[model samples]
Target: MRPPCHAVLPVIACALGALFHATQAAAALKPAQLAIVINDADPDSVAMGEYYRKRRGIPATNVVHVSIPGKPRSIGVAQFRLLKQAIDSKLGPSIQAVLMVWTAPYAVQCNAITAAYTLGYDARQCAHTCAAGQPSAYFNSASKRPYTDHGLRPSMLLPTALPPIAGPPASLAPEQARQGAQALVERGVAAGARSLPASAYYLATSEVARNSRAGFFPPAGHLPAHRLTIRRMTADVLEGAHDVLVYQTGMAQVAKLETLAFVPGALADHLTSHGGDLLGSSQMSSLRWLAAGATASYGTVSEPCNHWQKFPNSAVLLRRYLGGDSAIEAYWKSVAWPAQGLFIGEPLAAPYAVASN
Candidate 1:
């Protein structure tokens, strides 16, 4: 997902909701020591920072909301340096994560700073521009590579959630989709033979496109789940990999969430005033597809789904991916009337299997 700082940055204000809405025995991250860097003086961003901290139990002081004044979308190298200087002055090395929440001031510029944070690069060493197709491509002049997806960093010890790509496929026609899929297959084959963890890719189908009311299952015409289609395709292309996985997240359920999505006040301001589609609810089907069966997530940005009424489907898929015992049970639990009594896991874990003699 894009970092909080970008031409159209989408930060994880509600990601904290996903991260720590409930308590479990598993280890959880402390929200304190996390700094939220905002450039625009948008009260919504500030309110979000406060909403999450207080409502979610994030330590108040941990949320630092900074405003950059009169800064253009493209901050020249000089202005970039000054912005960095200001951030570094107040930045305590103890800060765990940085959320750049500016959408109007410039998302690409925001990416410049946040990229530095993710890469473990010295904030001062951040450059001014990133090349096309490069991670920091849309970032302002003082940008830096924030690892593969520009915002996601690979954890040395744990498996990271791979991001899923959203938006229109490179090819819209069946033939183009076939060709594109074939190319990706070839690339995976090469990467797998080299013994590297393969890049995972998934797609979401629109409701009208598939003519389905539900959102979790792919229609008959589309590619199936990881085991049947994706993994099979990967095997066909590449040799010698036991752990790599290729999969397709379902689309039927996602459409439900899309129908329910409403742009929040803060992001609405960005889109209306600044002329960009920065704020709105994520497609439920899209989020499920992203979270399916991955230890972590990466890819195009999707809005947080915790607050939505139609989010139980998302929770079910998340539970399934995160270790919900069974998708059916997870769905039932999430949809049960008491709503507040549901005991979904905090860090949804993979389901534990029963041993047979």
Candidate 2:
């Protein structure tokens, strides 16, 4: 028995625990199907693009070159529209996923640029930060080709600056960004095409408001087929885990991350209002997950009022990832309403691709 779904909107909250039992073999995303967008003006972006292209063997045709002013952290709708047009026109018809290379301009108006690009600009998100912004077609869907099947591209950010530089000279920022990006790309490329044995941590934090995602946590056990162990516990911060694959918890400021070790192609994130503010978020930035050795993470750019729909639903994400969907697919599919959230990481990381039935 399930609640009635709205005619125009899909039912988001449903019992789909059985979804984890089956893998979507058709949902495997390939490197050629992904398009990497680079800001030619930004040398760091260009350098990271080339490095990722070579490492992932992404075709030159799939590399998109655009010239956009990379200064503002959030650009107006007008400027974003123009920039999106330039990149969209060249994406052609086969690109299913997009990788944006740059740090600034992660948000357009109030919506995350990654969400705005895939779902189109949501004027409503800017109008009310706490209101339901926009419904996504790819949310929890079994669609393999988001662009071809759903007519919408799924995008993630491969920022030039992953673990952002703090108290560093302006001249050293680009070099440091290049090194960080190179490390991120290497981690992603190394996490895939095989079965992996890893642990998924779901912590019930003391912050009641931030723990909206607690209900969505999957049971704690070992699924030998996928080589995954799901663990549920009540703790504020995780410590001394050597094989961390999924670390999803709610906290304004996550502490003691250095105490744990994250596996390659790992997915980790904290639930908070400003985690998506990549540059100067008051809370811990999503970038910290990457710095802590996780391959991908998500965070909301604006105030979302702790709506579970605005954050990644762990059940859906775990199912999709175990089902052979890439990092971008699983992360993007988990969020019911993603207009306010930002997806950042290597889009192609799929450590469990070989385990799917």
Candidate 3:
């Protein structure tokens, strides 16, 4: 026989209380520690820069502008060094994170733009290409400022939809790009009040090689009360889910994407080849998630990084976010090997930073 409803109330209350207490101890990253980098040569970059500065209230001194040709998806090592030097000279040493407001030149040869800025461009980091690079100092750290804490600064790209013909599109016609960028700020602000309806996580168990990441999924019953609800699925794909906060899976292409409804501050990513190569059309690009309404996403820039450790750990990503880290910080910390990974999205969204009522 089952216990009466009244008898179960105490146990439920205890679980909720424990969750509330854990959330209360979390910490958040400050906006002042972030710097905005704009590619002045690109019109779309300039427009997005202005919009982000106004939306995030970033100080004028913290905004650094550099001139680089808009064509060619990659830049030479020397060119990247000069660009990095200009940024360092302009922003000083106080800033710990950067938001690059352009999509072109996402790579500096073999290195992703985000990795180049954060760890500095070095052939050694990409010597093996598929092999892991040096581990990040910012990974799983509790420091408020990365510069002071780890001597390493992390960065994220505020991606723009590429023009159909390789030239800049009508400046005003880029409203779709602005929608995703604006959503990040709006969602971060909204997170401070009400939590999303529910949070869903998907784990695919069909393919043995791709299923390596499934072990990290947290038990559903252990999740926080009324804040996030987790569901673990063994199917190869998940569909028709609503109000998704965090979605992780692995596949060459994820079908039925329209069936999932993402909350404004949601974070979603798939472990797949070329998902990080936003310029490629062969596989589903990570940018599609942003277009589909997710605030942030990640993917590998090159071929065949089958190492599960090279990707983001589902549990670490969720726990860090729930502990009040911003999307960038939590995402950076979740990945053990980020040298080849491209992190693109709104860096400052923090849904779990809100206080419980």
Candidate 4:
């Protein structure tokens, strides 16, 4: 006989571990029938989901992992077929979000066809194109250098008179990484020390939210590329909800250093079109809003992630400003790396709030 669903319950429980926390008193998050489509069986994605499920006390059954066709590196038509099948089988009207892990050619296809056309997170591709077949930067220094047909490479710091760059190289020596970091700090300071953008800050927050204990810091350079991805993904997700809150956290110094780049005007415009507001909350220091878009209201939250032991109380101010859940802080603290003292967690809890909206 096939194993009963409850048989897997223990395994799921073990996998979930310290991550799950129960929510009884607060307003319930409207369930979003979320569907997670993965490129392959990766430890990172699996660990990430487990963290979210247990941290939020979402039932094990609520998180489904669907495997795609093809090798882990290449996401071609076969991979697309599996992804489409997974979505067609599981996605219903109640589903609010679909997160795809890893980059694939089909990822662009899926985002364009499903996220853009079907989910209404549409976008116009920018014309500032990199040369075709120039080569891919699987691993290169933060310098804004052209690429060649190199298979895989190490990261190196370029000389001055160049923009800084960042991102983990597939295989970078420690000395190389150190030099790169130094170069980035110098170049970043010289560039009038511009802040990246609200979206970039949000992405950093997500990484912090997901793996704060991992000691992950944004690489020295590559701020523009980071900003582009964060803006696109957050904008897409926010468009589907009536209100979305993003929490940006860092060391007081780094947070202060990057504050100038959080462009409220650009993010506000994106938010306003979706009938949403973009609020930045920090735990360490303050973030200055450089600009505001026409439709959305842009501002900051005063607290940081470590104070979440007081989640119920801090959220009082958040509800006053954005009008969402109070229990979210409690829920986040129970499961997340609260000791790390990163960003706020309301936006992470937004799915629960904006479900009916």
After the best TM-score superposition of candidate 1, give how far the Cα of residue 25 lies from its true spot, in angstroms: 9.5
Weakest lDDT window of 10 consecutive positions for candidate 1? 263-272
Q: Could you give candidate 4's per-residue lDDT for residues 74-170 as a string of tens digits?
A: 2334545565566546544444334343222222221222222122221222121111111112111111111122221111101111111121122
Give RMSD to native, each candidate: 19.2, 3.1, 7.9, 22.2
Candidate 4, 134: how far from true, in Å?
31
Off by over 4 Å in 1: 1-26, 70-72, 106-113, 120-201, 204-357
For model 1, what is the error of residue 334's alpha carbon versus the real structure, in angstroms, after optimal superposition? Answer: 28
Candidate 4 residue runs with Cα over 4 Å from true position: 1-32, 38-40, 69-78, 91-94, 101-106, 109-347, 351-357
Error of 1 at 66 (Å): 3.0
Model 3 per-residue lDDT tens digits across residues 177-272: 566556655665555555557676767756556666666665565365546787777776767888788888887677666678878668888888
- Model 1, 1-357: lDDT tens digits are 211222221322224234222222122223343455544465534543443344335554544445666534344445556655565566554554344433323322323232333332322222321111122222211111122224322111011111223443221454443333233222212321232233222233332232111232222221222121222121112223233333333232222212221110000000011111122233321222222222212111112122112123232233222231221122222221111111111111122212122
> Which 10 consecutive residues of model 3 have the lowest summed lDDT?
1-10
Give the residue spans of candidate 2 off by over 4 A: 1-13, 24-27, 164-174, 193-196, 355-357
> Which residue pairs clash in candidate 2?
none
* Pick by TM-score: 1 or 3, better one: 3
Model 4: number of clashes?
16
Worst 10 residues of 2 by lDDT: 1-10
On lDDT, the leading prediction is 2
The alpha-carbon lDDT assigned to residue 133 of candidate 4 equals: 12
Q: After superposition, how far is residue 345 of candidate 3 from its true place, in Å?
A: 0.9
TM-score between model 4 and native: 0.31
Which model scores highest in TM-score?
2
lDDT of each: 0.27, 0.83, 0.71, 0.25
